[model samples]
Target chain A: MSERLHDRTRLRPPAPASIGDRVEDVGSPALLVDLDAFDHNLAQMQGLADAGGVALRPHAKAHKSVAVAQRQIAAGAVGICCQKLSEAYPFAAFGIADIHISNEFVGADKLAMAVELARHVNLSICVDDVRQVAAMASAAEAGGVRITVLPEVDVGHGRCGVNSTEALSRLADAIGEAPSLRFGGLQAYHGGAQHLPVWVQRRQAAQRAAEAVDGYVRHLDARGVSCPVITGGGTGTAEFDCQSGVYTEVQPGTYLFLDGHYGASEWLGQFRPRHSLFLSATVMSTARPGVVVCDVGLKSVAVDSGLPRLWSRDRSGWLRYVAANDEHGVLEVLNGDSQALLGSKLLLVPGHCDPTANLHAQFVCLREGRVVGLWEVDARGLSR
Target chain B: MSERLHDRTRLRPPAPASIGDRVEDVGSPALLVDLDAFDHNLAQMQGLADAGGVALRPHAKAHKSVAVAQRQIAAGAVGICCQKLSEAYPFAAFGIADIHISNEFVGADKLAMAVELARHVNLSICVDDVRQVAAMASAAEAGGVRITVLPEVDVGHGRCGVNSTEALSRLADAIGEAPSLRFGGLQAYHGGAQHLPVWVQRRQAAQRAAEAVDGYVRHLDARGVSCPVITGGGTGTAEFDCQSGVYTEVQPGTYLFLDGHYGASEWLGQFRPRHSLFLSATVMSTARPGVVVCDVGLKSVAVDSGLPRLWSRDRSGWLRYVAANDEHGVLEVLNGDSQALLGSKLLLVPGHCDPTANLHAQFVCLREGRVVGLWEVDARGLSR
Candidate 1:
């Protein structure tokens, strides 16, 4: 075990940049956080949530950095939401008292992890089935930890959560019967509605989701059950969600670091998202005419949403990231000299921030073209 | 620095499976290697290389594990190829003396890394530009290291490398002039031809690439330069590449762990690749009828080549992984009950093995339903 640890310590690459280094000195394929924009986005989202009268729990799954999470907490966030039990560990260990695992889990291993985490922090989990409730209850009871349970009601996401009111009621009753469980509220998240592209469509989707949650809440109220918190929403639909008057808490993760996917979406609301995250890549090769390959590719950025866009301050659109291979991102020089771009640093706005941010070990926080600090991606590769 | 190290130690999640643990006991979204099939792949690839009379230098960009690389070396592999200079550090530190950076690099940071690596191992790197050769020569001279330089010639990949024989001659001459640089040979890799579904198309592409490389070799020969090595070829075209009588060595990274993309390709040759790599996922949600959500998703697997395919023995096509979100894989139950699959484990053949392997911290090696070993993905995120 000691030998393995030694190997790991040796295997880790040096951080891309150090404090007080120029932005160009940062290594290629590093995740860069524009601190100025990051701070603006943070305060902007907090103000939006405050104005909407909803508790703001930024999803830690987006950044996966304890430093970012601490900033979010300091910026008036109520708590944070994690998509997995293992992903909640770093936040919990770093003085984060409240965390909600906004997803479902099963099996003895996951149950053990959940119960163990409950011992350290105020842990809440979502469930859509009676079996899951029973298993979590058993594990929580055996661990002597009270786990706040949220019956995930399918508010039109159609992926996870109970579809019907009866199923939600059954899950709530099952949690109520468990001595170590507390019925927190409802998990009404419409993941599909987050990126509808059309403003009216997004608004309507959020409205339907809110209506479904309201129906579930009314059903619970009729059964003499008190619901305290209703948490849902993402960066794309947080405005509509908070305005729906049905959700008590909103979880907007990507609002702090807008990506190409969200940048292409229609934004008519007051919550203006700034592009805080950028992939610092170097032009590695300019062998082909009119085309240069950057160091960022499938391993450095996520392409599921779409290819990353080159960050252009003047919107010149001179360089287009056309394709991505495993270790090379092929960029076509629309109107610039490819040779001049060689060895030059370019900032890229990743298509999707979540998976792209997960690819790097640390974030090179930049302020006015100078690296101010480095933040560890604390929960990277913690998909378990 | 000590505080940061402590935080990193606390941030890392526990390994999914300990040695000798049951296969089912492994945590969800863990990279699993079937030892029975893995050993067969290792021996089979070596046998193929022996029969073809070509050197087998497996690309470490695929598995990125020292244990796997050590096994390959023990099975008669010549050396190993890494796509980046930073990636070669682990292999060098772990006592692997021969390493090749089979791709081009630029910038002072990359040059420093190359010089540092050359001081520790027999480091070989590829270059296509004279400017790159000049920079590398200066770095090697300053570091007092003799670095092997391979001129990369474009042999139909159309992404990197020099295009014409004139360019190749210039690069070779530049390398020969450098006092600290040894003109190793040529790098002619047709990455685009590696995944053609039709066998004939792949063969023709390999033939064209071989012919182009032969032309470059003749050009070098006419210039009174003796090329010691001609390296290039991936898993998809290794068979044709070795028999072409041009390539002295082949770098077949994915041959050891056949993926869905390769499985879907036509293999009319004797190289019977086996599916040894798998993503062990468990069903976490069965909320929607006829569909079950597994814990494996974009964070756990690479979707660049295509979506992963469920591994089924007996041709039972009961489950299909239809969609992947950030943290959930939606599997459609074709003929089986979704409820029965809840909390059950399923082995998934990743679409592409390289990036998928990069997503995990370690691989759980399973032999006869029990974990025999855990191999760290030593250079998991060393993309720079």
Candidate 2:
């Protein structure tokens, strides 16, 4: 029993890969980031944001890594956007001065978090209702901190935010009335419009969203209210949004790690999204002919957008991720040798980067086919 | 700057709920387990396994909580099955002396974990290939641990395991040759058949799997190899698997907390699976007339099986979770009041329990509409 207790004490799960280890030696089902491609993506997005004259506030909800956010800030991002109050904790702790909660949140607990976060950073949060404003203002006052309040306007997303100008005005008025709150700007984001697949459809969606934002801005202007910053735009529609002249700041999270869904989209714009993130999965089973099962599945990668695409250097398309169970990803070997593939590590570009990144505890930072570092997905599962 | 640093030091995300908080007062997008229903589920599964005369080894992959596993152990579960080596860490650390890795794994890292775990616990792992056997044997021998090897046979679960008795015999021989290995019987599981929806179909599938197991056992018997345990079953087929008389032990994970997918299935069996688990989501947005968005989405719940069903006490079907974004669940109000739902906490029955449970850090344990305790999701993202 003493030995058993000692053994238990010594049992620690091995890290996916040590620093300087080759990519092939990394453990299966690891979240991997190609540092070269990541750097390229960072420079590219920064360049685009610079040329377009828009403040880049890359959403940290996609990576949830302080390292990634720090790199983004170093590359000239004005701030970072987090979808939840808890998600912004790590970035706040890491001393990222500006963080925005890009989604609506309620409850005293969330308000308390917002207030707490406001004390450390230039914390901003979105709200679509007057009740939320009152609660947030009360918490901010109680905590002796001022919070930037953005009234999210439904710019054709139809998910969250006020659709009507009256509702928007009410929220803006409420924020303006609160002494501890500053009416920062409008959160006019059309999340659904970001992934229309076709370039023309996405452009049209962005145009409609821009028009809606213009209307909301004009309405506020008519009421002698100056909208300081209009924050809303994702990886898909950032190019068009920057050209819209309506959004002062853009939040493009997936731009850093272009996923299978984004890669499938027609990118006629200047923003070149290279696939930087990958699920390093090993071909665990090759019992059946023409089929191999990898160690990645629903737990390792998100299938909300679609099954991950097998990332091949030559775009061979020999192996296709056919299905995903809890801990197994079934891949159909179209023309490759399944036997030879056994025990070999394969890179999978996830369907959705945000949720897929949220699945892993850390990202194996890879450079020149070797692990350079491991970055903790610090705010992972911080959905509250 | 010092004040900011001090504030950052104090910035910690609050717990979802305190020990004595009311159910409604708990934070949004929290994983909740109804203790009453959970206890009922525990007793029911135990009763089912007891009556069937089969040892119950509940799968911990569904609820990776040590507290839940402890409860299961106290309630009569022989052991627990974790899919990944890393996932079994907390349970083993918490003094779970018996554990089974019910899936095949590769890599030196995983083998090392297997050997290390074997030292403290009765660690049994599944394998389909002879190559895996040699590596595992070497690791176990070097670690000075006797690791039980279960040769997984593909009983219609085409994902993993050997299809033929010849291959199975080869694996068994490989285990027999290994000094630090024990041939612990077969892992004949059909994961795809678990959610067949129809009872007769599931029963037929279970029977076919039983026949397959029986054939494999006979092949081993012909070689004078005694198969002490034949373990393979899940919530959907536990009833039929136990009755098969072929399986000495049945592994059912989801029976303790039935998800929407399992709850939707036609259960004509004696095992009464109850809905114990829930995703506590708050209606954060009610801007649209008929549509309200909750704070639970891809980050909070798994939508791989299907979108989460709104769990209402009255079963009025007033609201339907139609779509899920990264952090938002769009619920369409069907003949109900959207305004009334705003700021109200709604219970969501996840589409799938395993992956959904993987998303949260802790489960807000509830008893009679009050928060009783908070159980950490010990192995929340230990996919590696």
Candidate 3:
């Protein structure tokens, strides 16, 4: 391992630049974050949160980086929401100050890890059942941490969380009854709403998710239970969620590096891609008649949602990535025509931004298409 | 980054064992590579490669680890083959001499990187077109290193490589025309045959691939072009390849870590799976009547091929990973029953072993269900 680390210094370092300097000479398979666009995305979300009269708890799951969260907080985000206890552990340790793990945790070990994180930062975790609340409370007591707990209600994504108001109240009551836990609020996140391709579908999904959470909140109010926060909304449906009035915090992450799928969506096309993330791969082989092989493949780009787009140059008529192995991507030229030559460089816009971001260890900051700085992805793969 | 690394180490370490210790942990998702079985598999391939009189250049793309490659080499492999230059870089840097990149090289910067690496090791790269040969020759001249170059011939996989014998000769002649490049052999890998599911289909594919390569070999021989090596074969078709007499080296990587997809194949089930690889995940939430949440998901496991199998447990009828998000996996209890309780650990056999191996940074070596040692996945995520 020590021997491996010896070659680290040999990696081409990012050239120092003035404010407007265009970064060049950075290697391929890099995560390029456009600072200007990233900042604007943050400010826009903060403005939306303010106008909606709701606290903005951005979802770290979309970015999973403390640096991005800090920028969000500086722009007026109340806190950040994380999807996993393992994912939240690094952010809490990095002094993010406030974090809401919006997923229910059942294991005592993970609950202990969460409670330990709460000792360092203000932590709130979600629970859909009383059994989870008991385990969290026990871990919190053992760790000497008073943790805030939220009842996660399934609004549209039928994965986990309480499906009814009764289940929400039972879990909330359990949290309130526990010595080391406090009932935080309702966590009603509609994960499916983030991927709705049309504006009408997104708006309808947000309305349904909002109504579900509103019903839970009204039930809590009837019982004299004061639920403070209702957190959940991704970048795909952030606009619809802002006007919904039911959500107290909108958790959007991909706005920092909007992907090809989001760019193609009718609902999100107007959002203007930040183009912050680009996988710059060199054309490795252009020998086959109309095909090209690239060094980046499934290991470099995440294709779970869809294939990556040719971001820099849309040689749509000539070539495109057809399939990918673990380390090599296969690009077949269309119509027996090939414009991409050997030794050419190409920029790839990953299909799913979040998973692609998770694949890299660091980010190369680019200004006007040149590398200027570098930032560690910080929490690249903290999937517990 | 250091802090995140610290957070990762907080988890329990794997146990160590003596050479003869046969320890088993009662759970699923635990990667159990049976030393005896793995040794047998390696020896079987070694014997076949030796009898066929071919140099065993086992492909590293499947395992992507130095430890596994070392074992393969020690078992009688001449060196190793890689799918990408980046994949070969780490192994080459770590003193794994005689490496052949089974793919092509075209990008000047990437070609230069490959040439620079050749300065420190015995490197042979593949090229399927004249342009790639020119770029490799240029880079090799610039780097002041002489490197072997192979012409990748497409047998049946409709990906990269030359289509005909004339194209193969033309590529070889182009390489011979280069000043700094030496003509190596031919790369005839049939990627599709590795997943054929049936022995007859696999054998038929191998025979077809062999015929295509034999035509090229005969053409090259008539043209007086020395065809020293004809390298290609995967775990699924290695047996047929050895008997075909067309290949001069067999490159099989997946036999070490037999995945769920490979293990479930009617043709491949005969290969024992306990020999290598399993994903260890903890049951995070099981409060839902017929659903349980796991710590691993799309982010942790590769689902490109299919969902992972609940390894070696009778709960196979009761448990199924029905859905997965980026970080959380939802396991559905089919019969509304599960022996897997909250906090119980489960070992999942991944669908595709290669991509899953690329996700992690290290392999936890366990002996007797406890911490033994840690082996770094030295070539992890080396896509470029």
Candidate 4:
């Protein structure tokens, strides 16, 4: 056990960047996380959580870095929430004592591994079905370990979980009665609602989610069960989740590193949190008169929400980014002054942060354009 | 240097599987490469290359695995092509003597690194302008190294490269005159034409690309410059490229792992090469009657080409994949006793293989449903 623990400790080494080196000197298409921006966003989210008197279990699935997770833990966050057993085990093995898998795990082997990991930490697994509950219970019983289980209630997303509070009650009751399982309140996440793009829509969605979760908590309370925690919120509706009055905990992932899609929100615009994450691509081609080719493509950043916004100065409005092949992004140069020559550096703000981070092995942590640190994305590729 | 080398060796430990463990026993949403199918595709592409008498430089950016590149090298492939300097360095370091960067690289540090890396292997980089030529020449001269250079010609793809043969001739002249560079011919890749969806359109696009490339080659040849190696083709246009007499070599990246987009081609439909790659997801939610949630999401796979197709049998057409949040994918069941309960597994064929493969750290190589090998994506995050 000591040997396995020691081996896992050195999972990722630091990236190729020395302190005080410029961001352009690091590498092309490298994931850059501005430390100043990250710290500001972290404090902002923590402040919101504190004001509501709720625990902050920021989703570790966003950055997938132990360094970021530890920073959150240091800043009054109770724990971190991972999305898979693979992600949860690494945190547990890395000595993170409190870890909750905000998603579900299936298969006997996966559940068994989750149960084994639970023996090392305060582990909570989510389930929306009696079958998943029974599997978790069986795995826990087999491992001779008690596991915390959460019943997910689908608020707005028709993707998973019980649609109603009544259905959630049955799953919660089953979890409470399971032989080796302890009921951990709820996983009431409105995933689709988080990207609604409108302030009122997102707030209303969070309000509805909170109300539905409270209804389930009431149902469980009347049946002699107590709700200890309720965690479900994302970067989009973090404020609404906090102000909803019933949520004891709000899980907001993407708050530390805002993407263009989430950053477009009016609420987020008011505070003006820095764009913490960026993809630094190089101008790979400048043969054409009015177009330039960049190195960041679909392989380096996600385009699900939209094409990445050009974050480079002096060329912002003059360059239009068009998603091309897997290895290239074409930027149309609108003016003569916007001459993006070969070897010139261009920074891109990813359309979505989570998947963009997943494309990188480590973050080139910068401070004012200088490389100050390197954070290994320890849980990267942690999707089971 | 040895210490850093040792640390890099341990970057990724063996994935959770021995030689004979079942696929389900491994992990959910893990990248799986069926070895038998992979071998078949490798041989199939090799056979085409042999028949056409053109060298096959299978683009390593598809799998990013040294294992896959080595197998290609073993199977009559002359070399491998990478899209970035960072991607090429790992292959060269892993003992691939011949490596080509199919795209232009920018930034001084990156160029210097490429020059340094070239000292250990046969490195060839692409350029489409005189500025890139001067930069490469300066770097190579400073490093006291001789490097191979390719001038890219834009063949109907307005993304990158010189648009006309006149421009290509000028660039070729510059490459041939560079102090520390050897003019290695042209990169005529029409990326836009690779996914025309229609057979005749794809073929015509390839023909047009070849005609334009030949015209440029003739232009260079007329000026007493030798076009030694003309390289460019892709999984979507491999046959068309081989049949075209102008291209001395073809770079086909995705042939070994046919995704749904490329696999939908009528020409590819003829031979029916095995779908070598897959994303295995677990049924995380079974609460809703007609829908089930899987662990694979936007982070686990790319949705740029289209949503992934359900590859598992008995429920293939019954389940329609709907992309949800970063952590979940919803599958709607159409009909029948295709009961996908929690813990039950489903296999998905990615819409596009390259970007999806980029999301994974390692490929869980399987044969007959059992783990056979673990291939670390040596250049997975080498997108610098």
Model 4 / residue B304 / CA error / Å: 0.9
Q: What is the C-alpha RMSD of each candidate to the true structure, in Å?
A: 2.1, 2.8, 4.1, 4.3
Ranking of models by lDDT? 1, 2, 4, 3
User: What C-alpha lDDT values do all the predictions have?
Assistant: 0.89, 0.89, 0.74, 0.80
Q: lDDT tens string, model 2, B43-141?
A: 988988888899999999999988888888989999999999999998888788899999988888888888878877899999999999999999988
What is the Å distance of residue A311 in model 2 from its true position?
0.9
Q: Where is the poorest 10-residue window by lDDT in model 3 chain B?
A: B9-18
What's the true lDDT of residue A240 in model 1? 84
The CAPRI category of model 4 is acceptable
Instruction: Give the range where candidate 3 chain A is weakest over 10 consecutive residues by summed lDDT.
Output: A9-18
Model 1 misplaced regions, further than 4 Å: A1-12, A314-316, B1-12, B314-316
Ranking 1 against 2 by DockQ, winner: 1
CA-based DockQ, model 4:
0.42
lDDT of 1 by residue, B102-218 (tens): 998888888988888887778999998999999999999999999999999999889999998888888988999999999999988999899898989999999999999999999
What residue pairs clash in candidate 1, if any at all?
none
Q: In model 3, which regions exceed 4 Å deviation?
A: A1-26, A268-275, B1-37, B268-275, B338-340, B366-371
Q: Which digits, one per residue and each the tens of the lDDT, describe model 3 over residues A1-384?
A: 112323432433222122343444456666677777777677776777688787888888777776777777878888888877667766766667798887766554466568667767788888776878888888888888899998888887877777777777788788889999988888877888888888788878888889888888999999999888878888877777778888878888887788877877774423444656778776666656777777678888888888887866546556788887776777777765453565566778899888888887767776676655666666666665
Model 4 / residue A282 / CA error / Å: 1.6
Please list all clashing residue pairs in model 2, or write none if there are none.
none
**Residue-wise C-alpha lDDT for candidate 4, range A1-384, written one tens digit per residue:** 001111211212225577788887776678888888999999998998898788899998888877787788989999998887777655665566788888776776577668677767888878887878887888789889998888888777766778876777778778878879999888888887788888788778878888887888788889888878888888888888887888888888898988988888767433346689998888877777888888888888889888998887777878878765687888888776434466777888998898888878778888888987778777777777
